[model samples]
Target: MEAGNATSAAVLQARELVKRFGGREALRGIDFEAAAGELVAVIGPNGAGKTTLLSILAGISRPDGGEVHVPQGEVGWVPQQAALYRRLTVEENLMLFARLEKHEDPRASTEQMLELTGLTERRGEIVARLSGGNQQRINIAIGLLARPSVLLLDEPSVGLDPRQRARLWEFVSALASEGGTTVIFSTHDIQEAERYGGRLLVLADGEALFDGSADGLREAVRREAPEAADQDFETAFVAFLHHRGH
Candidate 1:
């Protein structure tokens, strides 16, 4: 995608975003934007409000302050788990979600989705019987059943092994490449973030500590604090946390 084209295709924008949980503030004046076909990762410490930010973006929860503007009919959401019905078959689960979204030809679309996720052979199998990776694939398929323009995932690779995680990344990358879907996800794995994310958003104490490409982040660390260059993302992340006093 050209720079101008990407900039023009901003699918989701959050400005001065804030979320409060009683006495605590989860997101504090956060600002974010995702362009068409861009893959961005939101990285933060345990309580840095990554989930809260994703929830508001997914419309699963509301924010206490700020504005979230997403183009109508452009957003799709996949939560942490493949929350399919254990008793339902893979095909059945996809069709059900499609129908719930008022999609036409849910059956056919479900079949196509199965093929896309490499679950065609297992379409008739019960979700409960599928492996953890396969089940998560179904979860992602259901989220994409609507053919959303903007895809939001909350720790989509949380419980999977290395191979499963890699497979999921491949699927997500293909989706963005082919469909121009703006993808945003949160992950605790810095390696995953480095490998998969086109851009990075580092949050600490509900504040954006870094907003740029992964390379840019590296450069920032090298420029601001040279000692962090040899460390991996986890260590660098901790350095950021400590430096920020979070």
Candidate 2:
């Protein structure tokens, strides 16, 4: 489905989602909706509950309050850390995840993901020998095997070079545009959100501070300070956060 038709249905929804880690509240009631074919970037400063929110969305952790509407076993989650079989070949690692996911045709899925990640050429090499970027690619491939309608990722580009990062974003964009997989990712890179995120969800101090497009976020910041028209996105975003006392 094209992005035009993506808005027909909401693939995920968080109604007052809340989470508490011991005494600290990780999420203070987050509400958001995700369309079936859009890349929604969740951006925030450190310790702003971005990870906690993704955990809830991925069903890895239960929220203390509120509700998230996502079907069981229909979500692909990639944590910041790479989870791969370092001793196995790239193809073998993908196959391992495919079987774990119980994909109807694990081999076919592995082939598709191998080609998708551009790992087909190096499929026979051990994962430990691959560069950090290639390992990250394999980590992403493992998540893609779930054939999820909604894919959630937490800082998947931590160690990639510029080219690798570009390739990864292109791959994700294709999934959202052609495959209609709703992609929700968390990032501290503000410019990334402005560049690739079709929609943006800004969290601060365990609360949702803004939810809209990059232009919308800029316009929102501009409303508070007309002098910010010339500033870059990072500057404007910090100003916006400062305004909210985050």
Candidate 3:
């Protein structure tokens, strides 16, 4: 759904997006938009096409139908898999990607990413030798090397411990709220969606079911299952899906 009526202000937009894998459809006529400096959470159960939607937005995949409009060469994508050169050190990996992205002054961008991602101390360490958290940090730092206007992360905090997850959120939240970068991330954690998402776009079976605030989602759940009016966010979401026969 459209985040707001101000479509001209949106930095990213997908209209009637459709994707299919073999006989099974992944996304169906999904319309989405995100304005500058907005933190949008893409949440749904497994097989909900959350990752598919992100891939399309990040320009990593093309939709079979519809269109996605974003500034060319200004989108950052962090997929579920680590896209780093394992044999290379953190600094080297950053430099390589910077050059690949044709970033002006690869050295300056590499150093900035190292410092911004708090990997300055570990810059010389091989990516294969770093912990999961540190590696994820490197992945994100590389995505940010070009100073993208829109950042798309698919399950970015998957393997991190609680402390690491907390730190990751702190950095991401500030990036959107203070740095004016549009951030869109997908996750199964409802609490994270409500806590970090300034806007939420929920998809089920490749269809967008809801798009708005956490409280707005609560109301949608309440309409679907009035008995769940007082239910917690996670429970309410489950009930909403169940009531819809999804």
Candidate 2 residues 27-139, lDDT tens each? 99788889888899999999999999999999989999999899678999998998888999999998888998888898999999999999899999999999888888888
RMSD of each: 3.0, 3.4, 1.6
* Root mean square deviation (Cα) for candidate 1: 3.0
- Per-residue lDDT of model 1, residues 1-246, tens digit only: 101112565779898999989899889998888898898988886888888899899888988899999877768889887777999998889989989988778888887898899999888899999888898889888889868988888899988998998899999998888878989999877778888998888887788777778877766666655577588766766775676677
Off by over 4 Å in 3: 1-8
lDDT of 2 at 179: 95
TM-score of 3: 0.95
**Candidate 3 lDDT by residue in tens digits, 25-141:** 999999888999999999999999999999999888899999999978889988788789999999999999999888789999999888888999989998999989888888888
Candidate 2 RMSD to the correct structure: 3.4
The regions of model 2 sitting more than 4 angstroms off are: 1-8
In candidate 3, position 44 carries an lDDT of 93
Q: Would you give me the overall lDDT of model 1? A: 0.83
